[model samples]
Target: MMTHIVSKATYRTHMIALFMCLTFLWPCAICLYCTDFSRNVDHYCSFCNAFIGTYE
Candidate 1:
């Protein structure tokens, strides 16, 4: 019984970590890629343009 409870808690912690990574990390990655591509092509993608002067 104690082992089962511990396992559940561990699983919940892992899930929270996964959720945080997906939520926060993916956006930064996308922004970086969008900016890099825009710089190379001399055209700002909509995603990069939308974020301009935002929260800066």
Candidate 2:
């Protein structure tokens, strides 16, 4: 029973780490593909256009 609880906690920690990595790395991935580093008036990349649009 204690081992099961420990395993569950470890699994949750792994998932949290995975989520953090995705949250950080996803923008880096977009920036890597971007040609223009300049930000528009809204402070987003002009080359990529929209953040949501990038996902699509």
Candidate 3:
């Protein structure tokens, strides 16, 4: 009985991790697909962008 419960809990934890990874990465993937970095950099200059662009 305890083993069964543990297995079910483990399965649920794995599913949640999979969902979180997909949710976080899906937007990043879409952004990469839609934008060319050079064009995007000029138009999308937030403070963070300027910092990274200048430093890197």
> Which whole-number lDDT from 0 to 100 does residue 10 have in model 2?
36
User: How accurate locally, in lDDT, is each candidate?
Assistant: 0.36, 0.36, 0.36
Off by over 4 Å in 3: 1-9, 25-56
How would you encode candidate 2's per-residue C-alpha lDDT over 2-48 as one tens digit per residue? 11111112343445456656888655444432422322212334455
- What digit string (tens of lDDT, one per residue) describes model 1 on residues 1-56? 11111111234344545665688865544444334322222222354343222111
lDDT of 3 by residue, 1-56 (tens): 11111111234344545665688865554444344422222222343333232211
Candidate 1 positional error at 17, Å: 0.4
Candidate 2, residue 54: CA error in Å?
A: 44
lDDT for predicted candidate 3 compared with the true structure: 0.36
The residue-level lDDT of candidate 2 at 45 comes to 43
TM-score (C-alpha) between model 1 and the true structure:
0.28
